[model samples]
Target: MTKHNNLQSISVRIAVKTPAVSRALEEIVSTLDGFEQQLDEKATQTDVLVLEVGDNPAKEFETVRALLEDGVVNQVFLTSAKTTTDILLPALRTGAKQFFQQPLVFQEVQQAFVDIHKERIAGEGIAVEKVSIKPGKMVSVLGAKGGVGTTTVAVNLAVSLNRLYPEKTIALVDMNRVLGEVTVFLDLQTEFNWDELVKNISRLDPAYLAKALIQSAPGLYVMPAPNSIESGSQVSSQVMKQVLETTKNSFDFVIVDAGTQVGASAFRIFSSSDTIALITTLSLPCIINVKRLLGTMRLLGSIPMNNINIIANRFEKKSAISLEDTEKMTGHSVYSTLPNDYQKTLEAINTGKPLVDVAKNSQLVKSLNKLAESLIVKEEPVVKRKSWFW
Candidate 1:
């Protein structure tokens, strides 16, 4: 079933004075599963209110504005047949989320209501988390340049770690936004993505978050990036921080495919990460970019030199620019190197399986396993806290 199949209950009231518009609004609201139109206009509190501006729009606007400021209405949708800047500007000033100018588009109206329902469901999902928790470490995999095998490293490393510690829960999040290919790489279809999680951030707890993530392996879960470019814009660094914080508290480890993004979001990830695996290739141009990226990170001062681990991806022993040259340029020692196995790596990606899953004995998979092993810090057994009442 689709996520929007079961819409939660929402009380709607129409204050449209236009007979035709009111009937249209009523008809549309009735068709929606969870939206119930209230006949009693005297009711002060409602989940949603559709208001139409008439000859005296000023009075109606003031009433709705007051209703919003006083918390009498959660959402106010404005509709009017007359397209006037005077009406549109005031409607927006009142904090209306949507404005439908006469001859309402059916699809737009339905989509707006669906969005409201999703938000309400998300809000209601918020509750006190009663589960015991152990905070996990976050490993952010970032590419020095495009096509530097960031997702490859992240996906395989996550699978390798899950294979090593079958009991531990691992979350692989695609933070590359719309361009993310983690899901494609893993060949997993998910009902939810980062955008959905961010929308329901207030409801984030172990159970809610678990529902949003799709399990790929026995102990590995994946969260893909938003599907559309427009959806990607809705994600903010603050929301990402909250999501990551909640995720880390629930899982044993989080592997983020950050995909060469440098911005507030990237900085936030770097700041919160236990390890920042900077992926680079054994080439002149890519190494130069890596050096610049390292310099930029140092200038920002959000990431420490020790926390940043530069892993040289697609390394060849006969390459002109060796690991030593890379170290000399970046001023940071190479954390680890994965052998250049182009054919095998491409085959694994094409098959939508991690290297460990497809070719368990390959040198690339072995190197990834070693990297995962070094990242695994043995934690002491979690002790349950006794209640004061006990």
Candidate 2:
């Protein structure tokens, strides 16, 4: 019921048989920020309950599960001197968020309490009703073939959105399993990657997600690909679906650099996206690939035809194939075009900066910015009603 530093106070109830573990838990809970110890033995409900195993371990586990299922306690932490599989597995299955041995480790207890505090804080944010903010929009950029500037468009568009809408939350995700260039494009050094999200799919709450994403200089949050092929291989389409679903509620816009990947996984990405920025050049092979990809999407019948937006990268008037010709070949009109600034784009990549930052006045940056603007949905203004007194 009390508040500490603007955070609601967390009430902790400790029920431990061991004298040493009881004392340690008391100390740890006392030291935790925004946490208060509930000494009332008769209290049935609390924010967090720390329970130690008793002689009848099975009965105790049942009681703990019931308490959680009935919403009597928000979270439960179990402790036991026995580290056997029977004890540990039951404790985990009983819905305990953390477990400590009889001889508790101070640092581990402290870290567990810290994680709980973060989750509680994030939970408060979620409890508040959504007013002006709605679910986020996702835009996935994919190249018809290699070297079509897919990453370039994704990175610069995200940066431009961050610049244009400073208050809105933006996320840039690299969906490539190996050798993804999203971080290199933005010059970002990420501590976490999409692999973490897949491994901790059950913990895909706001608190965990915030920790897994790193914010770049432009204020856009980025989730890079795995560092190695093995880690990338562990990510599955179902897990990526969960990640995207969780992120949609947390940000205003999510930009994905879906580097040339095909199959069920790639299909999931394209289907989940609100707009699929299919990037290609005027080359014949690229056009043919585009036509094939379109047919694949059409056959799958997951994404709408209009949702696929064809973008011509490095467009030049003298190119072998014109935009109209390419459209006729692919059965889709060109949605947008980026001017060919080979030298400028190269310098931007070499410097690890977005085209917008490298040359704001250049045609490439202008085109990218315009592309970013088209994806944003403008909210209608609310009309004020006249007061009776007025």
TM-score of each model, paired residue for residue: 0.65, 0.69
lDDT of 2 by residue, 1-390 (tens): 123477778899988988988999999888767899998878878999999997899999999999999999998989899866567656756777776765777776776777677667677774432334345789999999988988988999999998987766788999988788888987877556888667767867554565567778545888889888899876788889889877776777889999888768889988889899999999999999999999999998999989999999999999989999999999999999999999999999999988877798998888888999886655642222211000
User: For candidate 1, what is the TM-score?
Assistant: 0.65
Clashes of each: 0, 0
Q: Candidate 1, which segments miss by more than 4 Å at Cα?
A: 1-132, 379-390
Which digits, one per residue and each the tens of the lDDT, describe model 1 over residues 1-92? 02344455689988888888888888888888767887786787898988887888888888888889999999888888876556765665
| Model 1 poorest ten-residue lDDT run | 381-390
- Model 2 steric clash total: 0
